[model samples]
Target: MSVYTQLTDDQFAAFCQSFGVSFARAIPITQGIKNSNWFIQTTDDTDGAPSYVFTLFEERPPADIEKMAVILNQLDGKLPVAAPLAVIESEAARTDNDKRYVIHYEDKAITLVPCLAGAHPEQTTQAMCHEIGAALALLHETLQALQPSEQYGVPLYPWSDVRDRESQFMPSDEAKLMRDIWHAYTQLPLATLPKGLCHLDMFADNTLWNLSLNNSQKGEARLTGLLDFTEVSAEHYVMDIAITINDFCTTWGDAEQGESVNFDRSKMAAFLQGYESKRPLGADEKRALPVMLAKAAVIFWLLRLNVIHYNRTEGRTGDNIMVKNPDLMKRLSAYHWSHVEKAQNTVFVLLNTHSNTDQNNQIVGVFSSITQAEQAREQLIRDQLTPDQLSNHSHFLIKEYTLDQLL
Candidate 1:
């Protein structure tokens, strides 16, 4: 029924016929904002290669599509990506009874790419983070070697480049905060931030993880598959790492309770540790990362709001690319903001009651609960007390004698 799906089917059949194979079946896989994909099985190739994926573009302008097609064909052997390989060219393409299926938007076209086989990680595990990080580092290295131009298929971030337009979608208070933060972010002096190719929106959905079959004795799980390269572009490469870390650190609602999911700072450390081994980040890049992470979280939260506002009640069929779980979004936004806030506050580990600090110096002496840290700070002010004598000092801080104050 959807034009996107039909066009994809037609394109697949055409590609099969061109390759001299009889297409017996086309199974739909994933259809998104930019493309519709299907798993194509044919009886033509006797070499035992029985499968391929057909991806038809839904929104690429003809010029961009043509440029993208050429770039993908050449870069396929180079990148671990989901870029399509052209089996059938536009010039010799066949027409169909269904006009929409046959006609390319803006005289556009389609291409087929082999689906990289593997399973995706469950948004947990240190191994998965390490792999993703290492792969991203490899990608950055590869892109760094390439010359930039139309062939590179550079991407544009509409919202970040247009925060005034984005603020309209946020809640009033958050919106004000967004404007201030966004302006400050855009105004940042990032003259020397490293730049290269980036999987700008590389989230859990795009990455495929390979798992060990239950009966197989292999102890390792494979996390190799990746998809949806429409957003792949040449840009500030560190944005990709920031996005990956943000996703890796996310925790949703109660459904994930009692699960083996926890953000091991070790994983974050390992990822950056590995990346730095490959390509080092400049001092400015390191400083800008926390801000960029905050920006990523804000963009997703606002975009989720847009999706809920437009799609929830309308009953329209489309891809889940932009779908955001409100609960998860809120949680992720809160977490990212906390990290940024803490980084800004120049405090990493907090000496709260839950921490393993020595009891004598712990915040418990001043505040009754974790929530009381703020109140304790305020109380110290009201009573004009010292930070140490004010209560809420964690056990880690050794106490110097306060007898001088007594005098």
Candidate 2:
């Protein structure tokens, strides 16, 4: 959250009072890029008074804010979501026709939600990754059951709108790389993949975790909250998984050569296992994962670039605003593509192979080709799963590899 619209102390207090909480102070939150947010403290000495987060819609309209509020309220206790609090006035004069949560200010909407507990993890653990993965899948299942209208849905990505901006703001090579990745993603059987409303921005900073009390006991951190529903939209379930993995599974390090971003394989496996425990991924989703990972990186890369472009062109500059580095995402995007290429170029060079299928002379050639193809994919499968786990996912892996080859 950034400070685009400054609010006076009186204004903040009045807003809090309308929700029946006496405001103590407003601490500006400068972590995110879109909305203006403050960690609000209340003056009440009551035993159950809770701290809140105040938000001003910097870029979103009132209607969008209202929809977000509705979505959050639906997900409130089931997940650790920051659902908007109903205003006292609205609760008193309740009616089906009137919206209760969003307050329309001059030209924007303001909402107050209870601040959740726990801190953002500085370094991610496999345990943490597992919890968030399961949480994301549950979010998908719950939201899909609601069957939200397309009118409130967001597109997969704004390729047409952002293509020109990418060419203008990025180096030629970087822009071209993005285009290639986008093209690959679009070629997938998107319609056949499972569709649902997804939390597109499930970054590590957007989640809160409670650290284990006994580090020596091998205890896992508990996921306390999932923040920032502003980017939630209807999309393929696999795309959502990719977006979460790009942030959760990659570790950043600085080296003598340059900045390095590498995937933590153990953590990635743990996450996938956790997700599968709730809802197993289909063969199509498995096949689409690689390109989607690259595509997800492109989205954040373009987003960071667009933020810089707007900050300069629109004269929105100050210490209060934070802009992330686009080069980091560029590096991530490149790494994903390189990893995919390495997986694809792996030669089977089988000396001896056995096939379970007994077929006619004509079909022997085709069966032999399929056997060789599976051998080629064996290394890639090992890269993702341990030898022990391979038996469990072999069918899914084969189907995924077959489809990927066809594509």
**TM-score list, all predictions:** 0.69, 0.82
- Model 1, TM vs. native: 0.69
Number of the predicted model whose lDDT against the real structure is largest:
2
Q: Taking the tens digit of each residue's C-alpha lDDT, what string does model 1 give over 216-260?
A: 235355555666656666667667787777776453334547322
lDDT of each: 0.55, 0.76
The true-versus-predicted C-alpha distance at residue 231 of model 1, in Å, is 1.0
- Each model's backbone clash number: 14, 1
lDDT tens readout by residue for model 2, 1-407: 78999999999999988877789889999998988999887876355434899999887777877778877877878899989988776446887766578887898989999989888876788778788889988888778656654555544456567767667766788878888888888889998999878889999999998865665156667888999988778888888898898899988665563666777655766677668768988878777787888888988888888888788888998899898877888888997776556555443222212233453111111112222344234434556456676655332232212323544
Give the distance in Å from residue 49's predicted Cα in candidate 1 to where it truly belongs.
10
Best by TM-score: 2
lDDT minimum window of 10 residues, candidate 1: 395-404
